[model samples]
Target: MIIRSATSDDVDAIWELNRQIGQYHFENVPDVFVAPSHLDREFLLAAIMDEHRLFSVAVDEERIVGFISARMDINENIPFVIKRPLCRIGSVVVDEDHRAKGVGKKLMEHCSSWANSNEAYQIRLEVMSFNSKAKSFYESLGFKPQSEIWAK
Candidate 1:
């Protein structure tokens, strides 16, 4: 397996991997997620082209098996809070067949390197409360919850 920065040529493969996770979210959280079809190629391409965002993919035998997208931003300007740069992971998906094989971990490691190079003070990501598998995976990586969102 190899991890590298994504390019325009990787859009299709990345989209397919995104669909895998998108489908899971749509089925498990219908209220907040739409079908994977709603996430069109153009939207993904724009994200890849964004200067503040970094997209990386894991390839195995020349086939893309996973991807992660993250963006660098400053903490919101608030009088009481200290300002700092942070990296927010937007999406991460490993092929269903590739799970538990460290593909996701490699992609995350790549994201961490990118974030550090960009001078980010922290890395943050969100996982739905019901996605226990993802939550556990994140915890295994030393991530602790900072907050939660509640909706009625």
Candidate 2:
């Protein structure tokens, strides 16, 4: 498998993967997520073109198997908080058939390298409470929870 920066040509496959994950979220957290549809292709293309962001895809045998999107940003400016650069992962999805085959890990590792190159001090992402499998996958990568958001 090869990991590379995403291009316009990869949008449809990425969108499909996004839909797959989005549906899972919608079902698991209906209060927070709605069924995903009609994603704006132009917006996705814009993300691909954005210099501060990284959108990448994992391909095997000419088929897209996974993707990750991340961006560099500064930690919020608060008097008590130390300022630092961070890479926030916005989304990651692996094709159902490609899970447990290391496609997701490879994609994440690619993003980590990119983040380091950009001088980021840390990497962060959110996994819903219901997704134990994803949580385990991330934990195995050495990620630790830094905060939690509680809802009524």
Among the numbered candidates, top lDDT falls to 1
Q: How many residue pairs in model 2 have overlapping backbones?
A: 0
In model 1, the worst 10-residue window by lDDT is 73-82
lDDT of 2 by residue, 1-152 (tens): 99999998888888888888989999999999989877546667788888779999999999998989999888586879757888999988999999999999999999999999988999999999899999999999999989988999
Worst 10 residues of 2 by lDDT: 37-46
The clash count of every prediction, one per candidate, is 0, 0
TM-score of candidate 1 versus the correct structure, residues matched by position: 0.95
Q: What is the C-alpha RMSD of each candidate to the true structure, in Å?
A: 1.2, 1.2
Q: How many Å off is the CA of 18 in candidate 1?
A: 0.8
| Tens digit of per-residue lDDT, candidate 1, span 1-68 | 99988899999998888888888999998999889884568899988888668888899999999999
TM-score of every candidate relative to the true structure: 0.95, 0.95
